[model samples]
Target: MAGTGICCASLEEPIALMKMGLSMVLIGHVNFLLGALVHGVVLRHINLHKQARAMEYAISNVVALTSGLVGIVVGILAIVLSKNKKSKGLTWSLFTVSLTAALMAAASAIGLSVITNECPFDPTRIYSTTLILWVPLIVTCVIQMVFSARCFAVCISFLGLPCCPNRKRTRPYGRAINVVRPLKGSRPISQY
Candidate 1:
């Protein structure tokens, strides 16, 4: 958790998060493409015995694709707005979108894993082909989830957004004293 926070905080550096945002867009496109491929190709050829499972998988794929699309949009926004340090509200909105997309990706991955595990591997290994295709989809979804979560952490920890309260100062008393240097030949001032 601390590691994640550190990583996310590092991304706030000028071009780092912008690069991260670009990568997020790439990952989102990959997820979207994989979801579409699985839905359009693999699902259509599923065996009747596993139709129910396939349907569930298909639904999860749809969720993945939807989340991917959302991720892409948010990523683009992040890239564009990264330069504006004071847009806390916008940053908060990005964090919210990222959090939601992360949740959806996680749920979709879980559903996919459950449905995949439920299906048995027969001698013919018909399902293996589907699994082969789906492995990338699962990997992409998890990857996107991680990316989104990272973005969430960055927004929360680094962005001193108005929505979240700032950390309290450790010392509430006097401010730091500015020390004055005596002239080269002058005697130091005496303190009581």
Candidate 2:
């Protein structure tokens, strides 16, 4: 009985961890992107041509926003799958979701890199704008990718769990232990 819990314990915890991590990442990413976009828009409206860096921020954010949304949604759905009573379908769904997150995150990262490289700091630039948001955006995307990987690992762990799943495999309800006979001649009592 003591060891009976090993399988279930291993699965339950990782699933919960995955769910929480993914949900947090999703919410944070949405808010952060929205704020970052607003900053870009405000800067652009004031003077776009003079603020090429702000434009870069706006374009990179727009590209990242779409993919970030997709990743968050898939991440949330993957969390939902963790609660399902029937885990049979879970592995494939989680696998696909996690894979999508990784790809989307990679795309976002690449887009940000391209924009940064294309818009290097120049001496001719007069107005200076703090560009701290870009690093965090990339970091958030990478975090999402990491959480997705964790979720996928949780899915893989399920594959190795005891085949019967949550259902107990004890003798049918009516069968009671027969204590009437001598404890002598026996198939070892240990199994019972």
Clashing pairs in 2: none
lDDT digits (tens) for residues 89-131 of candidate 2: 6667766767676666666666665544444334232223323
Worst 10 residues of 1 by lDDT: 1-10
TM-score leader: 1
Residue 183, candidate 2: alpha-carbon lDDT: 65
Global CA lDDT computed for model 1: 0.76
Q: What total of clashing residue pairs does each candidate reach?
A: 0, 0
Candidate 2: regions farther than 4 A off: 1-15, 18-28, 31-60, 114-130, 159-192
* Candidate 1 lDDT over residue span 1-192, tens digit each: 244532455666657678778888998999898888777766666664755645676678789899889879768867876787568777888888989989999988887777545663352555766677678888988988888887886787557656644454356566998999987978778842
RMSD of each: 5.3, 9.3
For model 1, which pairs clash? none
